[model samples]
Target: MSISPLKETIPKLDPPNNTSLHPPPSPSTHRTLRRLKSAHVLGSSVSQPSLISQQHKQSLNRNFSPTRKVTNPPPGAHTRTRSNSDANVMSPALSSPISRRPQMKRASPVEGSTLDRLIRDGPTEGDLERGLESMRLKILDQGVKSDGDGMSSLRIYVWLVLLNAPVLETDEYLSLIHRGASPAYSKIRNDTFRTLATDPLFRRRVSEASLIRLLNAVAWKLHDAKGERSEVQMRLTNTANIYGSPELQHATPAKGRSRATTLTNDGSDAGKSEPGTYVQGMNVLAAPFLYAARSEAEAFIAFHQFITTECPGYVRGAMDGVHKGLALVDKVLAIVDPKLSLYLIGKGMNAELYAFPSVLTLCACTPPLPEVLRLWDFLFAYGAHLNILCIVAQLVILRNSILNSPSPTKILRSFPPLQADIVKEVTLTLVKKIPDDIYAEIVIHAK
Candidate 1:
C-alpha cells in the first residue's frame, strides 16, 4: 500500500492565469428549490396524486445520478492541480484536510447489498418528526446484522449525506455530527453512523458500481425523509402555532473568527485568483458548487448577524443570486395557496434555527443522497417557496436537537477537518423524512 507523493498529487494545472475562463457567481443558484423540512409532510400543493409518480418520472429524467453522470469532468470544469492553482489563489482558510489525506491507492470495490425488507413501506399517520424517530427505531430494530452488508453500507452513505448537509456554518462539516456538537444525534445517531461510514474495509469490499448504486439508493431513501416517509411535518399543524415574525433561535453568533473569503482574490495582477479559475486555480474553489456554496455560507453568516445585529438589507441584496435561486420555489408555491407567505416560518423560531443556507444548497454541491432526496421531496411538494424556509427549518431542527450541544464553537472548530462518511450520514438523519402536513406560523402571527 503506497501513498501518492505529497504536495504534487492533486489534479495538475498550467496557465499563468485562467480568470477569463471563470463563470459568474450563482447563475443557476436560483434555478431550483429544495424542500428539506418536509419533503412529504406540510408539503402543500402537490397536485395530490401527481406528486411522486410525476416527480419520480422527472427525477429519473433530469436528476443527474452522480454514480452515472460523473463519468467525465463537466465541460470546462477545472482539471488543474493544487500547486498550479495555488500560485494564483490564496490557500483555503482550512488546513490540508485529513479527510482528503493521501490514501493507499484507490480502494477496491465493496460488496453489493441485498435490500432489507425490514424498513416499513413509509411514514405512518404520525408526523415526519415522529416518523424519523420511528424510522430510526426501525433501523435500530434491524439489529445491525439484519440488513446484509450492502444495505447497511448504503444506509451509512445516506446518513453521511444528511448530517454533513451544508445547512449551517460550514466551519467544520463533519464535526457537527460527531463528538457532541448537537447532543440530539451526537449521543446516539453519530456513533451508529460513524461505524458505518468509517467502514472502509467494507466499502472497498463492495464493487465500485454497486457502491455507487447503493449511495444513489440511499439518497433516494432519505430524500423523502421529511415528506410522506418523513418523521415530522414541515409547518405547524395548528393555526395558533403560526407566528408572524421570524424570531431568533441561536441568534447568538457561533464562536469563531469570521473569515470571509471574498469572491475575487485580491490584487490587480491576480493570475489564477480570478473567480472563474477559483475551482481549478484554487483548492478552495475545487467543486463546481462552491460558487453558490460560498454565497450560501456568507448568506447564513449574514442572516445570523441580521437576527442579532439587524444589519441593513445589504444581506438581502447580497442574497440576490440565491434569492432567485429560492424564488423559483415561491413561484411554484403560489399555485398551492396564494395566502401562504412562501416563507414557511414556524412560530417555533424561538424554538429553533431552520435549515441554514448551507443546508439549503445541500452542502453547496456535495449534497449526499439524503439531503438531495429530502430536498427533492420538498421541491416536489411546494416548488420553490420551500427552499430557504426548508434551509431555515433544517437549521432550526439542528438547533432544537442540539439544545444540549456541549459547545457549538468546539464542534464548529472541530470541523473543516475530516471528511469521514459518518459525519455525512449524521447530516441525513437531521434532514430526515419531510412532513406530510404543516400549519403556518404567519397566520398565527396575525391572530
Candidate 2:
C-alpha cells in the first residue's frame, strides 16, 4: 500500500544534421501542404463548433449594432453606451438612414370651385365676351363666398373685371389725386362722414379721409370731362356759325348732349354729365367698392366705371334711373305678386314712398355687409337693373307679413337683411313670369 516514486519517460531521438534531408517542397507538394493545413483548420472548427458559433454571433452583433463602433465617428455624432440586452432589442427605426419629416399638405379640388375658376380664367384670358358670360354663369351657379381676406382680394378683382375698369398706372392715379378737391368737395366731405356709418365692416375697414379723397378725385375727373366736352361743343358750334353750312348744323346737333343712353360697355359719353354733379346716395353705392377694394385708387376706378358706364342715370340729372328703377319695382311686384302689390298700393306704399333707399343705393341700404356683398356679386354679374326684380322678390317673400302687418310701410321702408340666394331664385322665376314688354323695359331701365 506504500506509494512508489513516479518515473519520467523521455522518447529517445537521434542527433539531426544541419542540412535538411528533405529538399524544399515542389509546387505540387506546397499545394498539398496548404490543403492539409486547411483540412486541419476545418477539423479544429468542427471539433469546437459551439465556441466558433458564439464568437461569430458576437462579431455580427458588434458590426450591425449602432451603439458600437470600431472607428472614429463623424462630427456632431455622440458616443452612447447601450446594454447588451438593449442592443439585442434595438428598434429598426433607430437604424434607418433617413430622418422623419412632416408630411406635405395636399391641394384641394378645383373642378367645381368658383374661386379656382376665377383665378384660372383671370380677367384677360379666353374670349372677352364668352369668358365674361361663362364667368357670370359660374358665379350664378356656384355663388361666390368671401373666403375671408383672400375673398376680399378676389372681390375687388372680380368687380374690376365685371365693371371693365382698366388698370391705370400708380403715377396716373397719384396725379389725379394731386389735382386737389373738386367743385363738389363740400358735398363729398359731408357724404364721406356719413357713408356706411352703421355697417361695422365699412366702419372697421375704410377711413373717412380715404372716402373723401376718392370721391373728390372722381368728382374732379367728372368735372374735367364735363368742362372739356362743353368747350369742344362750343368750339364746334362756333365753327358751324362761322361756316354756316347745313352739314355743320347737323353735326352741331349731334353734339347736343353726351349722357349715356344705355347701360352697356359702350358707354355713350364718358365725358359729359347730364346732372353735371355728384349727388347724395353716391357714398352708399361707393361703399361696397371701397369696402372690397384694396386701395382708394382701385375703389375710385371701379366706382367711376360703375357710375359712368353701367348705371349713369342713377347719378345723372334728377337720378332718373333710380326713379325708373323704383317704378319697375312696383310694376314687377304688381306682376309677380299682385296680391302684395295691391295690398301695398292700398296702404299708399308705392316704391317711391318706401323703396327709394333700396333703389338709390342699389339695395346696399340693407344691413349685414356680408349679405350685401353676396347681393352685389349678383348685381355686378348680371345687369344692376335686375336689382328692381330683386326688390320685388323681397316684397313677394314678405307678402304674408305685409298683408297682415298693421304698418306695412314701416316694414317695407328698410328691407330686412337681404338673403341674396333666395332673392336670386325669386327674381329668376319672375323673369319667366313677367310680360315681354315689361322685361324689355327692365333691360333698358338702368340705361
lDDT over C-alpha atoms for residue 129 of model 1? 28
Clashes of 2: 0
Per-model C-alpha lDDT, please?
0.24, 0.58
lDDT of 2 by residue, 29-51 (tens): 11111221121121221223221
RMSD of each: 26.3, 37.9
Q: Which consecutive 10 residues in model 2 have the weakest lDDT in total?
A: 1-10
Model 1 whole-model lDDT (C-alpha atoms): 0.24
Leading candidate by lDDT = 2
Please provide, for model 1 over 223-320, each residue's C-alpha lDDT reduced to its tens digit, 9 standing for 90 to 100. 33313421232232222124422222223323211111111123222212111100111111111121112222222222222111111111221333
Q: Which stretches of candidate 2 lie over 4 Å from their true place?
A: 1-114, 120-125, 148-151, 245-273
What's model 2's TM-score? 0.67
Model 1: residues >4 Å from true position, as ranges? Answer: 1-360, 363-368, 410-447
